[model samples]
Target chain A: MSLEKQIAISPAGELAAKLNSAQLPVDACYQCKKCSSGCPLTFAMDLLPDQVIRLALLGQEEQVLGAVTPWVCSSCETCTTRCPNGIDIAGVMDWLKEEALRRGYSIPQVQISRFHQSFLETVRLGGGRLSEPLLLGLYSLRSGKTLEKLKSGELKDELLLGWELVRRGRLKPKLPKKLKGAGEIAAFFAKSER
Target chain B: MKVSYYPGCSLEETAIDYAESIAAVAPLLDLELAELEDWNCCGASAAHSINHTLALDLSARNLLIARQAGLDLVVPCALCFNRLKVAEKALPVPQENKGKTQPPVKVWDLLDYLTQPEFLKSLAGKVVRPLAGLKAVCYYGCLAARPPKVTDKEAYENPGNMEALLRALGAEPLDWSYKTDCCGAGLALARPDIIDTLVKRLYDRALAAGAECFVVSCQMCQANLDLPQKRIAKKAGRDYYLPVLYFTELIGLALAHPEVDKWLARHLVDPRPLLKKLGALSAFA
Candidate 1:
């Protein structure tokens, strides 16, 4: 029986330093598998939540950034809540996704990334609030899921649901009134970018 | 008691039933809920994923508004509450505003706010119609109770606050697994396959535990569980038309509010038949 764990020597400490600066204790993980065991989306992830942390600790920055696990993370905080070591595992995932985007890495989970962009753009245009219909329209256009839905005949179901929601007053077709501090909110985004 | 209400984005659209019911019951509980003027989104699951500072600033702006209004905050959406609470803690100390201390604004999830002893006593006395025959599983979802250090919940997994409120309204709160389970959160929008899997599991567990319906605190959970059940059922070749309802709507029903039916009608799966069968509909009638 092999009692040794394989080690990879690499200059991946850059990712670790970034995570530390972001206040994530990636080094505190001990592979208890508590996080992986509890993550609802673990089955869909290319690397389990625990494996992502292990990669981060090992300085496997390229692999961690390239993996779809972080994008697939729902940020439900299940792993963070259940971690015995008190690691903010979900927070680490969020950082990984941001790092990937910042570095212009090709995200494997394209639709999820596009959805995030669409969501933020909606908030930005709506003056920090989300308008559901506008968001749905923009997301569909950006993700190209609208064409897919049309092809698969799922568009009908979506349209029906939209009609039902609007009828029930659960959704409004008109644009919402922009908040009074729209300029300040937009300036906040601009300053954060700088 | 008065509090600044932050409905978040969902309440303005998808979770309007929750907004309506909360408004409908506010007078009964003697709680004045003033909408936070010109509030914005809490940055939810997406902002943190894209830019950490963006998420913090979005929530901080709202908190600053509530603080400036001189009122404590009451948030109904669990995701909003979690994000706002995290932002409140993580907002960077502005260099220009150094040495100026702002009073801490108390934020309360609606369930936590209503479960306080004084509020519960008032609620109990105002139950014009108790939910006598209704049976439900209180589904807290993930964000509402998780990372207890942030939310300050006593027990994330087995929190009894929602059940306690259910009991107060004379409904049987069934014990079940998946109370704090993840229902795929924002993934419901981007990845329905994952949501389908998660919601199917929740339905199987809830049905096995004899839950007539699911009572939830988060809008995402209600949307995930309610909107996808039909497709999940078709794919699994099973019948699972379980009603996923906001806990606020259930409280409205228990209070015998005339508009409960209007609220229930917004559900994709018609919950009225089940409510009628359980003798829950007559209260609204």
Candidate 2:
């Protein structure tokens, strides 16, 4: 259907209009919970995928965007594949994640907003690639690994694992090096503000 | 026989063992891998989860490089393949590379590339030391086998390429349900409890099906499964030790690469004992 038709059909709800504007097929979902049932990580989500889509159709913008489902989603796409309406449900979650960021709604650890922020920083550190230790280190700092917890040995297991890998000669110490053409990639990312 | 290879960043870090194995076995399989020059990250799950355009742009850069190479791009890491395939899917319609006339570079998951019918037929003839008694389950995770429209994988939910590849190498590939299940990979650091739950579920089902080891192509799945066994065992109150070896590592073993011991040694849960018990370990490996 055309954007005109989508707008005409969903004129009553702000959320529906937003979904249509974003090109998500919000009008097609009929409240079948196949997405919810098939979701592997719903136990930690505040709203199931189906419930969030339903809220979007009803123009419940606050609930739709504020729900932790988007951040909790791992982009597994089982929900998208299993959807009878071809709703691109995982894409919906991605959109919601970005939307939530724009709208300033986030939960620190449970929803992974901090982790993602750290990830972008890590990527920038590598110019356009990823440095594993940098990502872990940045995330650990941003997620607020308190000194008291560190002193209490809360991270003992993780530290022990790190030591083991290092001892096995798996980790080589090095500073992040720029890729040959990374200057162009850096300018592109900066212009996009990603 | 020659393909541009994208090892992804994890292959340099957490999954270095998987990379070492691929380097050892690709030659034996008559596959030549030229690393995609100056390839960077595909933005991974992090870029895609937020900033969809950046995800596409990041992956599009790698795709452009692979197209310049003028060869099919074979990615051993499932996550990198997914991100690149996503960008490739948008090449024609999206404005990023709409006017470029170069032929679209074909992106292939390593397992799918290795399991082509002719390749499998040849692979069967090349296995010198058959892994006769090894029982392994192929854990695909959700990277390469979902959203069929994007990944171009038919029967996405029921992928059999890994099974076909394993069987050709004379290993018994078991039928299992969690083959395409998500192990909560992207959110692993954010919410480890969720990962533990998902991993335990898969492990229980795999154990029930009599699987001795897991063969994974994704390094994220390997880390998610391999790193948590001791914790899960303590929580579930059971002995914890199940090897999560990469598909490439197992192929190295089957092809009689003695240095497989070096790769397998990197795994958290040792796989050599099981291989030794079954007499599946190749000489000196």
**What lDDT tens digits, residue by residue, belong to model 1 across residues A21-113?**
878978888899999998888889889898888889988888889999999888888899889988899999888898899899999999999
Residue B29 C-alpha lDDT in model 1 = 80
The top-ranked prediction according to lDDT is 1
Predictions: Cα RMSD each:
2.7, 4.5
* Model 2 C-alpha lDDT per residue in residues B43-128, reported as the tens digit of each score: 88788877787788888889888987988999988889999988888776323355765555689998888788998898788788
As a whole number from 0 to 100, the lDDT of residue B154 in candidate 2 is 91
All candidates' TM-scores? 0.95, 0.93
Candidate 1 Cα RMSD (Å): 2.7
Instruction: Report lDDT (Cα) of residue B89, candidate 2.
Output: 80
In model 1, which residue pairs have backbone atoms overlapping below 3 Å? none
CAPRI grade, predicted model 2: medium
lDDT score at residue A153, model 2, on the 0-100 scale: 72
TM-score of chain A of each: 0.92, 0.85
Please give, for residues A101-142, the per-residue lDDT of candidate 2 as tens digits.
Answer: 877775434338878878877887888778888887788888
Q: Model 2 TM-score?
A: 0.93
